[model samples]
Target chain A: MDRKDLKEKLLKIGDLATLPVVAYNVMQLTQNPKASAMDVGKAISQDPALTSKVLKIANSSFYGFPQKISTINNAIVILGFSNIRNIVISAGIIDAYKVEKSSAHFDRTEFWKHSLACGITSKIIASTVGLKNSEEAFIWGILHDIGKIVMDTYIHEEYSQVVQTAKEKGMLIVDAEQTYLGFNHTTVGTLVARKWNMPPALLKVIRYHHNPVLDYNSLRISSIVHLADILCRTLDLGSGGDNEIPIVNEKSWDLMNLDKQTVKTIFAEMEKEYESATAFLH
Target chain B: MNKNKGLHDKSASQDQIDIIEQKYARLKENEPMKILLNAAKEYLTEKGQEKNGS
Candidate 1:
């Protein structure tokens, strides 16, 4: 299929736009500079489930905020509007893409575990690298492989075959998709990101995560997420649909400017946070 | 920065892929993070020793 046809097929797989009403409203509210914290807070409170999850994340060890954050308003204030938006969007994405119980080969739980691991790892990397808005890195990590989920959900039969081909051929899933499906997950994910009106930073990360060539502006975020994805896969944080590892793009690695010591530190931090994070997010 | 190279190189073999797949599977079956942590530690230790030697 051509790129246009593939995107249409992906969009039709499920309601890609079916964010929870609260999440959709929160997203719209966040776009308004004049929107107050209370406005955002009120929108989030409209969904009891989202409120609980947001509060749970606020108190989770992942954030490591010292003071207790019990209320949605408090979470909105303490975590900031953007962070609250990230939390709400994450909850919304999880809801929108609720997978069936794992098939014999693919495990949805494991897939999400990988995503959570990447998010945590990316956040740590961003902070260590002195990037502003490191929390955005967390959201990027979570949404990076959204394309894979799109494929799995919409075209389970073809997706299962793709996974099998990757393993059997010792190929990356992206490569297998190119051979079988004409376009890869990155293309599908980019289209999804555009449709959802995700921020350009996030859209670039989702699009170029597999191949962080730095042609785009969000190179820093994309590179951070790229390295985080590899690290998570290396540690087997959760299955990313296939077992084969992609070659670490030398440029992407260089973009990280990580020393051996930094890698050790990052791994140490991950050790401390991985369990709590997986539990908190999952 | 290098350009987009798409997934695997043409020459990556099934055997190499299987080895990695098995290694990750074992890591998952056992303590996944533990193995990764140990790997990181060993690398640091080796780097330290190499610095001392040089």
Candidate 2:
């Protein structure tokens, strides 16, 4: 199928935009001015998997909680909606990334690991920059490369060649895709976002994440996603051969609100955390 | 961050093991991934039959 036809397919899928029932309820609670801890707990309790996952996370070393969190209501009051949202989104992402019929051009497990790393990194960067709701930044990082999924399914019918070209030219998969198929994953991803009716901010991040150096109004967000993706790739967490390390953009650096030394410090810290996080893999 | 920590308590060591399984599935293992990729291809081509290499 051609790009246009695939675009139609993605629009029809609509699964990504149609938030899980729990997420939808959580989103509503967030909008509720009178939303109490109980209200948040009630919403999460509806989903058993979410309930367990959240409780499991609350007990991790990150929290150092002395007491066991038993019910959704208590967990919500204790953990707050922000952390709940992160767990929900992370759970949703892991499920969404399970590739039943995957293209060889893409590595499903690696894609997930890299995306998770990027999400974590971007949230850290966004917070350091004093951006409100670093959680949103984390979500954006989770989704920035989602376009790759669509591209693999539609354009790269002959997946082996796509992989070879990316390696041979030392090009990112998106670049190789454009050279061979006349369109890239970013543009396709932007189209995918449009179909999802996502917020404009997110659309901009997806479209321009590959080329943060390009002058754009949403330059800061784009730069964070761009930088996060590269750092994950460089660390070789889940990076494919196609992606490359980008030259740090001076403009992006300015927007980061952290100086070179501060960023380096964070990078060192992130490396340790990333190793710990990936240690879960082992 | 501790907010989420309360939630993690529900997961036992086995739960941790399961999560670790998925996590490790995505590591930088060139040889294993290459093997998986090749097997997937062979499965696709042979249409559920024995392939040349297998």
Candidate 3:
């Protein structure tokens, strides 16, 4: 579909404009220059389900909190606005997508698991590389392939050729996308993000989330996410769209200043973490 | 930063009607974000038409 048609179409699949009211409210609260624990707490209180999920995620073993956080106010106060905002976005968006099991190829839960793994692995790489916003990296990693979810659903019957082509070439799925469909997921992802009016930084990350070299100027974030996806997929984190291993973004090594040993160590660490991460899928 | 919220949210957002019009201009180039968002946008449009056509 073309851009104009795409925009009109997405409005029907779902009206992102009418996003969960609480999420909208949270966005407003977080946008406040003087946003405080009270402001966030007051906002979160509007959505009990989201509040609980954010609180659970806040005190989650993921953050390695020393003590369990008991209240929304505490979650905001402890995790702060930036961290809380990320969690809120995750909680809201994860539930936001309308994911149904693909008839062929990918299983639904595995796809989401892949996203989660990529997110965690990206954070790991981001932290090691001293990126400014590791959590944001995690979010980007987590949602990098979200366009695939939309694509798979939109052209489930027609796009079978695209999936098969990726398998035959033994290349990253996006390579197949470029060849079979005349565009790659990164390109598609960029368009979708732009259509959604996602942050330009995010759009860049999504556009090059699979290709660091293509985006020479903004290599850091995209490269990190690109590498994290490779590492996660290498470890068989989960099936992200296509099952074949795509070529790892080699520039990621230089971009992040990672060496063979550093790569090994991070991969090993991600390996140990993966076992625990998959456990959360159910 | 123009700080246009339209630049950040989906084009369907009522606040930014022009954004979609501008995006429509670049529809076929197959820019990354467009393809991804197009899948959903197309589905919704088809679904809407089906509902209306029904």
Candidate 4:
């Protein structure tokens, strides 16, 4: 179908996959300059399941906290508004996109493992490269391939055809999607992120992750996530729906200016953090 | 006849080697991918050694 029709269909699907009310409220509260920790905590506490998940993640090895973090208010205090916001949104997105079925070619668990790996790797890359806000990088990495799931859920038959075409032709899923569906996941992902009112940087990362050089404004974050996706695939962290790795964008790679030694350090840290970060999936 | 059989076997093994090489050729050619893969290999090897030592 055309872009307009595709977006209309995806917008409908976006409505169905709305973020939980508490998660939505927390996102809004954290963005407000006047909102306090108690306000955000109170919003989160409204959803007991989300509250517990947030607390569990705060105490998990992902954060590497030595002392136990027993309450939502404490988590808010220690992690700060942005970090807490990232955690809440991550939990909310995962809950919203709960997969009900798996096909022969795609396993939902493996897809998520890949996404989580990308998130951890992106955080590490962001820190290594001295970009501010590694937490934001983590969420970007997690949500990068969200369009794939959106399509898979909303338009299963066609998406399966796209996956099948990729497998048969040994093409990247994006390319297959372009050739088959007339538009790729990036297009669909941008639409979904817009529907969620995600920030411009995030929307750009979701859209331009494959070709980060396209957007000059958010190039650094986009490039960091791009490299992270490749590294995760290299280490076999998880499957990104297809086996083939996209060629590294030469401009983006040059921008990173990562030396061999720095690359080694990043890989080592990713290996350690990935083992613990899988807790987010559970 | 034995010499011909040995030649055949060598050619068959060479074909298998070629197939394996082709599989990795894409990764080997990409400079950035090469860097990441090498680091991943070293990291995995180091982890394996650590496991064994412990």
Q: How much of the real interface does each model capture, measured as fnat?
A: 0.06, 0.00, 0.00, 0.53
Clash tally for model 2? 17
Off by over 4 Å in 1: A1-8, A11-17, A65-68, A279-282, B1-54
| Cα-lDDT of candidate 4 | 0.79
lDDT of 3 by residue, A1-282 (tens): 544564455444343323456765676676578877787788888888887888777766666679989998888777777778767766776666544555565455667778888878888898998878676776687778876766666656435666766656555677776666665566556665665555566777888876678777788888888877766654456667665444445466556776555665675567466655542343
Give the range of the ten consecutive residues with the poorest summed lDDT in model 3 chain A: A10-19
Pick by lDDT: 1 or 3, better one: 1
Tell me the TM-score of model 1: 0.80
lDDT of 4 by residue, B1-54 (tens): 121222123343344334323434655376776675566555555555555564
Q: Candidate 2 vs candidate 3: which has greater TM-score?
A: 3
| Strongest candidate by DockQ | 4
Candidate 4 per-residue lDDT, tens place, A1-282, comes to 665776577668767656678877887787688999999989999998988889989999988899999999999888888888888988887877774576767667778888989989998999888898777898899899988988888877778878887978878899998887777889888887788777777899999999998988979989999999988776667777876778788889989999777887887787689888866777
Give lDDT: candidate 4, residue A97: 72
Residue A14 Cα positional deviation in candidate 1, in Å, after optimal superposition:
8.6
The candidates' interface RMSDs, in order, read 9.2, 16.8, 16.1, 4.5
Better of 3 and 4 by DockQ: 4
Ranked candidates (lDDT, high to low): 4, 1, 3, 2
Query: Per-residue lDDT of A1-282 in model 2, one digit per residue for the tens?
Result: 565765565565444434456765675676578987777777778878767776776666544568988876666667777766666655654554465645666666667677767877888788778888876887678778767765555544644476678877766677676776566667767876666555677788888897876736778889888777755654445654364544445567566655444554455445455544542222
When sorted by TM-score, best at the front, the candidate numbers are 4, 1, 3, 2
Q: Scored by CA lDDT, what does every candidate get?
A: 0.73, 0.61, 0.63, 0.79
The candidate, 1 or 2, that scores higher on lDDT is 1
